[model samples]
Target: MALDTLDLGVLAAIVLAIVIYFTKGSLWGKSDGEDVSVPRGSSRDLVEILAANNKKALVLFASQTGTAEDYSHKFAKEFQSRFSIPTMCGDLADYDYENLNEIFTSIDGFQLVVFFTATYGEGEPPDNAVEFFDYLENECDDLSNLKFSCFGLGNSTYEFYNAMGKKTVSTLTEKGATLVGELGLGDDGRGTMDEDYMAWKDGLFDILKDQLSLEEHELVYEPQIKIEESVLTIDSPEVSLGEPDDKYINPSQEEAQSLNEGPFDHTHPYLAPITVSRELFNSDSRHCIHAEFDISDSNLKYTTGDHLAIWPSNSNEHVFKFLDILGLSEKKDVVIDIKSLDPTVHPHVISPSTYEAVVRHYLEISGPVSRQFVGSVAQFAPTEQAKAHASKLGKDKALFHEEVTSRYLNIADLLHVLSDGVKWTSIPFAFIIESVAHLQPRYYSISSSSLSEKQAIHVTAVVEQEKYPNVDHIVTGVATNLLFNIQLAQNKVSNVKPVVTYDLAGPRQKFAPFKLPVHVRRSTFKLPSNPATPIICIGPGTGVAPFRGFIRERVAQTANDISVGKTLLFFGCRNSSEDFLYKDEFVDYSKKLGEKFELVTAFSRETAEKVYVQHKMLERAKEISELLNDGAFFYVCGDAARMARDVQNVLIRIMMSERKVTESIATDMVKNLRVLNRYQEDVW
Candidate 1:
């Protein structure tokens, strides 16, 4: 119950999951619960469940937001096809772990594959995988015959980077499971994660040969399903998309009852109508917009700490670059049919959609192209000369990264430089789908309370549009620009505005037919269950999103019953006069809450030097410590890499200096916030 890896049944489940992960595709898709929820006495089936010779490769995903699940499916697809391994995918919660050793002892002829697994929230395994990890660490069993490999994905910025994967691998090895290779570490801290993986893949292959005495086989690109006369589409057309129709928007009684889970997700999306939009910038630096999407038809619900994913398309300019480089801008056979031998995360490229859709929607071709992507498809050149050229470019990373990614060149642009209009056949369709995070929604923190606005959500997004240090004319964010443009469009259409000029047939037609698809995700960061809890908040710039909602809820509660605790907000900005957002509104909140509310402002650019939110926290350390001692809930919402961590350090110092406690004890005092549910962070 305390989340230690000590249960016998839990240990059994972890072994089974590690062993049977690759078989997710072969068994589960048959609509059989038979292969799932490992039964109490099925020891033999559990072992066979992991063996790949005749069984499915289990793909057990420990995911926070489905990214791991998606990547695991893609790996499962390639693993099954490349090695003739069958895959079975499952969520960690599916198995009860009541009998895990049966799984541990039976992994002799099996292959174990893990993807993007690690725990958040103080190194506890992801919410769903908690029990499994605990069981594996605490349980006892031998798995010497086990053949396994691991791919650990985590950001290096965290304290316990990939600790879950590292701990699991060590625990399994201690129990006699023979690991097939060196652990694969995928660090997103630096931008070179993809490159780092390519190196890891090569080393993993070498280790696999030495451990299994396996000979290298020609890994041909084979799809699970064969397409005959199939169009060049990547995904199924009938799957579901497009704006809601008249029948789709407002549902009948029965339909409403059936709409508990929204059709909109990473795989499928509901394109809602835009109800409002507006631009927030006056100069050419960048644009920020406030826009809302109507989701009445879908059952998507969200709390204040959630994020929204938006799907966007490549600008026509980038599309042309891809077309020109591939020399397919004029060809008619530029179609693709994707097939997976295993269950794919969501075969992002399997479209009846067309080659254009694959390039524009399925792939991030317009963004920076890693040298590994270029190397992977290099042999598929249309001509021998081009193949040689591509090979050289791949080996010479400096030249490639500089001329291509640095120049903002896409895949198509690179292909054109290597080839002279010839065609090659060695490239695989699986690489594109397997290589990336899906082109889905980018999340923004909710700036409004659902209690106050009910159906409406507010997000204060700052557009990131600027040129890089070396690159010219670069765009900052895809979703931000999309939102900003939508805002401008709405303002022009409104009859109340006076000084507005927006041409429907002007230069912004690349996003000509723009509609938004949105979905919500839940978060555990919530307000205190009791309204009488005192709160201390620090929100600098747009980081103020959640604090606004927190204050609103408190203000509303006070208005209703006249019972509440003190509220203090530490707000920071560049200038008090130029762009101090929510300055006027703080006065209103203070008046409503009377002496119970306080607002502290810090202007980073008030003078030649700059000051930020963390400085303000130190300035009020005495008050902050006193409030914490009085059981006040503290919330931090801002940049995760620096500001959040800096503020944390400041809080620790306050506890140390003012309370006269040793560093270690002060650290625990801060950690106690998480344990007592008094401290929370919504930083990404």
Candidate 2:
């Protein structure tokens, strides 16, 4: 069966296609000699890496937004410093876990593995941990010699809180792994994540001391990374002044154009132009921005229900204040090169970068100060009184919360208050880099349908501003206010000043004219594949974001003469005239869809009694029950703390009343819907 010339050509073409698909056409690209790939640590074999390094303990993290990773590094650092046991910190995604037993048996001594995992959307393991979870569940069988501990980071408001961390412990135990201590769960919902982590660390240390016959050393600060002040100016091509990667720093014209091209992801973001920016609400005190990004040129794609990750920069005010407090005001523009001293530790910021760039773009400079961090910084205090105050705040939880946490004081704010405007020149810049969490991108539910717009991504964000009773300073949201400022700049809104000033022009004025660094994140919260499947969307306030996409999606389908579903949206706001979002747009949708579309309004402040979406949902209980019976998809988006819960409860009540079922049975029915993916939520 010798192949003909045409058959041979076809075979060659197929092979070429396969190569192109796998390599994303990089196989036939121009040679630059430089590796564009991210620096993942050497070696994927966990046991081999540990054995080579002579590390008795391995701390692995599965992080979504760097929190879990940060905790793992912190744990590894402390474990080594206190127990004198060399520990290696690794990303779970980087290491292979097939030889789990070898870590204990093949290693020099009884090796220990510690997991710090954050549970992502709906009890799912984060993107990086998926393969590990699959292996643990289906492939892995034995781990008799394994000893492990786990600490989970999560928001208590979610139903499946700390699910991945708990899963790790349970699965490992089932496979004969011995658990060292109780699984630790850090709750962000209660604002006790830091405190919870601290408590867990102390308890874990106590257990390790007894079990391993380890001697505790004084927990002195040791910098994992070396930061040296470089002679390079900000204008130097080698210096990184807020650019995400090497490719973004002073690229050629062709390279600049390529930045907007795919594959846009978490590592690579597209510099999207702001096509539209306007305020949604008419209220004076509060504001909601409805901004649209033009992805026409960029190859970035999205669906009806997805998230847009907006990379933001710290405000000029915050950055300057932080530099001033740290006594790095004059040296802010001076370039500094950062190199990791330990093999396991990776510097978060790109080097060589300026102090201003690190503060503005790399580190989270405007979040609540950590209690443990306060105690750590006490030694670096400018005065004895400041040191004592810091020590007291660190030791006493109540006082720390009262003075720092409740006041929404950041690192600089806390330092200023602690020393009464004295500069803390003793604190090492490397310590600052190690202590603070890396600045993370904020995600918003995209408000436009890809089917309708195709090339545009819409974001509906409510600018968060909270004025506490005792605190004179208002706590402003980092990302939302940034978006608001961008909106103001784009629209040329005069006479009204921005709440916070940002370097919107970006590095080297690359992002000049209104632009933002954005990437799309796919979500499971999607519309049904069948166009005729009815949907009940309860989204109060800005939670209505995805539902708007849902409605517009159905409208788009209708334009194609497709049999559109009976779309129902329950929206609640403070007042109908003031904060009713997308009011006119919904009316236009209603006109287009006619009897198929329904907009249920719940204006809380309009009446004597404050009414919400749940109350409105209850009013349409019979309709909801019928829709459920007819295989309608149920969706809820908004505050996970209360609104989502209330809506779920209301749904259960609707089922119980309409179907004459018991409360338990109704609850089970709702749970079943969730399991079947008929019910979904996009809440924060």
Candidate 3:
């Protein structure tokens, strides 16, 4: 039993490792060092994170992109700031649901668990939430001791409004989990998600006030992260100037080529060449681009009726404006390192990047400013008077709406309007990244059929440009305008005034042939399994994208000597001469389909009275009713707020009138169609 110095050192190291394992938790996908660095935006185990943070309640989020995640973080902060509750927010995908039962025994409090889930496409859970959802529904059952609260983020326009939220609440209750608050539902379709959330939280607080003995505190601004300025310049080889990952930041020729080989996905998109790009419309005021992406070498597969999510960069115009307002114009190229002060929270965007990179490639500097964000940034106003003005505006929801949201004024514009051209230099850079959402991918319904062309994905996007009454700058969509620029360059179209430009060459000329960063998002809106199954499509404007795919598939089926069923498409636009999308192609398809296909047109601006798709649907009530009776699949892809709602009502009326059924019966029939997957939608 001789204890040598080396033996003692080895023993000490083993003890230290065990201590770190329990205290700091697993380094799981992190660096194994004294100072660990977790990858930005990556999820960690919720149970471990909560334990390490010494938290009581854990807010688990099932986010599709980042909206649900944003809400979860906001709720966590509010729970702490308002009620003095120690909370931990985490992604549902990052934790094991099997250990959920242990939470009741581990945390000695009433506020144990909370769920925030976003419903994606029909009643499906988000991609990340899929595994967790399966476990909850199939595996885990006994959750009697689990006390939880729930909230749902969804669009009311969809048939299954807040479906995921409802499912989560019901499943948890069925499994014997104690529900704390009334399940909150937020509808983005009504443009009142924030209001709905606030209303729900107010009620939840009333319940929690007595249950947790919570005390309201004065709201104060707190930074979740801290920024460390780096010595690296924007031009430095190691510095990532808007490059998506480390591979793009600094890659050898072989590494770069290997990166492009396979697994072309959301994280690493293939720079697929654009084979075709042209204007689909003949309108002087509006422009719609039809672009075909060559995915021959991408190893990416997509069926008809799927979505192509194009990752877009912020326009230079908006980037410059934001940089100027933040007084980062002079130091745009200055590289900075962002790290989360709280071990539980992660930095929103990838770091070791320049200010210009973060602004141009990551942050959403275009959308309407939130009242909470306005309040958060008010303390950093250039002057005391400006601060007071901003604070007052933030406090008054109506005034904030009237001044900021109503005017579509973003953060840069709001600051400019309040400070009268003075810069908000005192505001921390980390706050901008945390406050503003990341630039999301614009999902377009695929217009090309997989049967017609397996190696290409077609997109029909109408460039959205709106001019406000008093605002000088035209509000142009970032992704649509980017697509327009790409089309211009591809077709050798002359540079038009007000056309938004991008770094089309991309970082280091990676995209050589008019390529864009994109990924395929599989959608539920699909053609029936059998070619003989009838289909009735209602698509107005660019909503006609997926219907185009469906028709193309039918045309291919007919060419192959396969018998096809009756296909009816109700399409609406301003006028057939100007804005009718794929006019020539439809004519060719109609020739092949003959009696099997029917195109119902609605030109709103052609006559004194406006005629929409819903009106066209009513005109063909007998046909639609007959088709539905024969088990026809109904598909709607367009404006969910008005067009989809109207078309749905028209269909119900058709069922009532033509079938001679009661309104309730017609409604049940429609609901039954949805339940049977006969009703499909691809609306935004």
Q: How accurate locally, in lDDT, is each candidate? A: 0.61, 0.88, 0.83
Better of 1 and 2 by lDDT: 2
Query: What TM-score, over all chains together, does every model reach?
Result: 0.77, 0.93, 0.91
lDDT of candidate 3 over 1-684, digit per residue (tens): 999999999999999899777655434533222123333233344454455566788898998867888888888887877877777788787767776877767656636588899999876898879998899888997999888888999999887799999999999999999898799999999898877887787789788887767788777656677677887777678776776556676889888777667575556766668899999999667999999999887677899999998877888888888999999999988889776666677765777888988888888788777787788788899998789999998778799888887888888899999999999999999878877878777889999999998899999999988887987677889989988888888888775654456777765566666888778888888899999999999999999999999999999999999998999998999999999999998898889999999899999999999999999888889988889889899999989888887878888898999989999999999989988999888888
Output the number of the TM-score-best candidate: 2
lDDT of 2: 0.88
Q: Candidate 2's residue-wise lDDT over 1-684, tens digit each?
A: 999999999999999989877765446431122122222366788776776656789898888877898888878887887778888888788878889877888877755889999999898888889999999999999988899999999988888888888899999999999999889999988878889999998998899889877789977887777788987899999788898667798789999889877798778788888889999999777899999999999889999899999988899989999999999999999999887666556787998899999999989999888898898899999999999999999899999888888888999999999999999999999999988888888999999999998999999999987787998888888889988898888888886776678999988887788888899999999999999999999999999999999999989999999998798889999998899999999889989999999999999998999999999999999999999999999999999888888899999999999999999999999999999999999999
TM-score ranking of the models: 2, 3, 1
Tell me which of candidates 2 and 3 scores higher on lDDT. Answer: 2
| C-alpha lDDT (0 to 100) for residue 574 of candidate 2 | 95
What are the RMSD figures for all models against the true structure?
11.4, 9.6, 4.5
In model 2, pairs of residues that clash are none
Q: Which of the predicted structures, 1 or 2, would earn the higher TM-score when compared with the native?
A: 2
Across 183-233, the per-residue lDDT of candidate 1 in tens digits comes to 777776665555566566668656656665545655544444332234322
Model 1, position 291, has a per-residue lDDT of 60
